[model samples]
Target: MITINEAYVDSLALNAAAVKNGRDLVKKNKITKRCRTEDKTLLFGDCQGSGKEPYRCSVDYLKPESPVYRCTCPSRQFPCKHILGLLYASAAGQTFSVEAIPQEIAEKRDKADKREEKKKEAIGVGSDEAAVPKRKTNKAALAKKINAQLEGVELLDKLIRQLVQNGVAGIDSKVLKMMDDQAKQLGNFYVPGLQNELRELILLIKENKDSESLYTEAMDQLTYLHALLRKSRDYLTSRKQNPELAMDSESGLEESIGHAWQLSELRDYGRVQAHVELAQLAFRSNLYAARSEYVDEGLWMDLSSGSLYVTRHYRPVKAAKYMKEEDSVFDIVKASELFIYPGELNPRVRWDDGPLRSMQAEDLERIHSYSRSSFTEVIKLVKNQLKNPLSDKHPVVLLRYSEIVVGEDDSYGLLDAQGKQIVLQDTAYLAHATTHLLPLLTPELAANQAMLVLFEHELSSGRLIAQPLSLVTKREIIRFIY
Candidate 1:
């Protein structure tokens, strides 16, 4: 039998109300008949409810850290109050006589085991002596695919040249429609990322049609597109010639042009395990014709490796709703080993199989030690990153800010000790600075306060903008997320 504690109960509850209601049920002795444990993995109980029959509750403790909960109660909340009550009673040291597993529970365990076995088999896990075979690749088929992609790139190049000749002022509804149509065509060639870039260019043109920097912004995007097209051609050629070249070796151009690596494949072949700090996080949702897209993005800094990683979780809006009710990726406010997907400059990662653990003082020290302290260093790094066509979101650390200037238009800017300044363009970060950071200042410090901040910086229309990750004042550190 597994020991369930209050910490485990709190983790399992949907919210504070659920915890209270479940504890109330347990205190009132609502749980009844046939409460037992089976195979040291399953716990079950009958709980009295308002209905004629008692609700059936069970907790599969096979994976104690991530228990599988089940109940017959008609509650939308996961695990329901009755399930929580059952676990609460078990945690309170209530003895459960050993019993044979019910057919329902047995079938569930069997199904779960079968699924796990199949996944292992797919990844070539057999007896210890068995060796996994290399995955077969059809070189001819791959060559044909690359050739088709190159054709799409050529078409994009022609469209870009035509747009430049027409001038930004001459672009109208018809031109915008043509670009949109061509972007859709690019998607047909498995280059959705490039298609996205094209769509963004069109949007930028439409939104800033009357602005003074319209021409500059349009040209910047066009230049980026041209570089991406050229780089993709080169990458594809090299990949076709040498199929053994590591795909995860920081092919920024390939990723920029929408080539993606399967997460399962990366986990099997190129996983990097480490403890990293989440420097920044953001979530965005968009409704399309048939479905909505939900994306969770995080900028993680590995304390041990001194490398930056970007982690993303995407789901349909309906599925996202369910996910929101549970712990978010940001909830892991601890130092724990995570499974990082492979990439040279900016890899992606996810939480590993363990309970979240808090960061130690040593972990914080390691992070501080690795941070770029000087403004000059930060500026140099930013300039170098901007040279990469796909370096739209490059991470930077401003170890200390010499001044925080609030502009007349309510915009904010930060000046480091070395006199380098960066504009804070994110409205959320500005609000956080005003509401949280400013109040923490002493009269003297407010006049000449030094603040530490982690941020992602990007160049837009010849201006640098900073999206704040965290701000450190004398009293506290505030993390901003949207």
Candidate 2:
């Protein structure tokens, strides 16, 4: 039988409620007919439910590292309460009879295997190792789309200018309604990105809670939207002339304008880096209310180049239950093929699933060396990136600190040996898990070690602040946020 513990079952829960419901099922003795294959590759059982018949569920561990939890329950959750109940039963050492796989499941598995083989053949990943051909861009179709996108860009710019000239006092419900309608129409113009931003701008205008704050954010959003329009128009115009142009590696304006990039295209455009080793410094999940999606963002450092990179996994809210949530990883990811998306100040990256192992002692030494010592240089670099309207304002950097300074405002800030200090505060977007955890560290260790922080420009304070993420010593890096 597959070895399992209650703690392991607990760790698999996506939410406290799910775990609680599962344990409740266990207590009620809802599970029955527990069985497993002779090899113990599959653990399956039926659990009594609200319906007349019990819900059939299985935990397929054919590939133990990537187990598949399946249940006939109507719940959208990947591992439904029934599946969890089964796992919890196994963890609780319930009696399970060894039996042959069900005929229906066996048939389903065979069909799935055939489908997998066909997919591998299509992707050129089969035993024969055939090379899949890259699809060429349809120039005529792409050029026509570019023209439409350019028209959308112009329409958006005109709307923005009208809004600016009319002033905030004139923005009533009718005006908001018109702007909202216009944003929806922009979707038909092949400018989903602009449409999203316009909606956000409209929302900012609608909320006048803090007038000063509203003015700051509204202006910032409007400024970025305006820049996006100009750059998008220029980009689409260029593509209109030659649709097969190279991907923009600099500003990533093509993608910024809502042009979806294929991984094959990015790779062919010289965005793939080989033999890249990345260590996850910190990870956070952000719910983008505007997009109605949850984005899992991980800050990673390139072990060889020591450059900061980001990995983003977006899970839409509607399909959140079906999709797996990307959690914090503690291993060193050694990817043979890494695809980097185009953008500034920590561009998003994706890599082929490959070797992952625990961090070694040498990994710590390399990470320590990557810590930037000069606050002056860090400030200059961050300022340059922030100047770009379309750039990510929250740039993450690792800083070597000498002391943790407590400001008169009762805020935490990091100070270097030469007395250059950067204040630390939790921003609205980047929530520091908890600043209270700072007191646990020894003052001497805190002074001598390096720290990873996310820099944000605080609108209310009118000052820049760094949100501390990880504290790094020579031996190991301790993370405060995920």
Best by lDDT: 2
Tell me the tens digit of each residue's lDDT in model 2 across 1-482: 34688777776877778889898898999997799999999999899999999999999877565677888989887688888889899889889999998887788778878997876555444323232234577888887787788888888899899988997667789988899889888988888778778877886787676777777788778889888888787777777777667557656676667767766566545667778999999888888766678989889999998888998888999987666678888889988778888888788888855467789989988998889988988999998988888888899999998898776777788887788998877776674455677778886766868999888888777788888888888788788877
Off by over 4 Å in 1: 1-61, 69-133, 206-209, 241-245, 267-271, 274-292, 322-337, 342-346, 360-362, 398-465, 472-476
Clashing pairs in 1: none
On the 0 to 100 scale, the lDDT of residue 284 in model 2 is: 82
92 Cα displacement, candidate 1 (Å): 12
Q: lDDT tens digits, residues 1-482, model 1?
A: 34578777877776688889989988999988535664578888899999899999888877755678898888877778898888888778877878888899889989999998987677554344222234566778877877787788788989988988888778889998998889778877867677778887887887755465677667778888888888877887788787656554444565676767654455455453434455332323333321245555555556556566666666566654334343333333333546655444556666644544454556555544554546677767776776675564455453556676677876667676666776766532223332334445455554333333434433334555665555544433345444
Instruction: Report the number of the highest-TM-score candidate.
Output: 2
What is candidate 1's CA lDDT for residue 116? 80
In terms of lDDT, the poorest run of 10 residues in model 2 is 125-134
By TM-score, how accurate is candidate 2? 0.85
RMSD of 1: 6.0
Candidate 2's error at 348, in angstroms?
A: 1.6
Candidate 1 C-alpha error for residue 268, in Å: 6.0
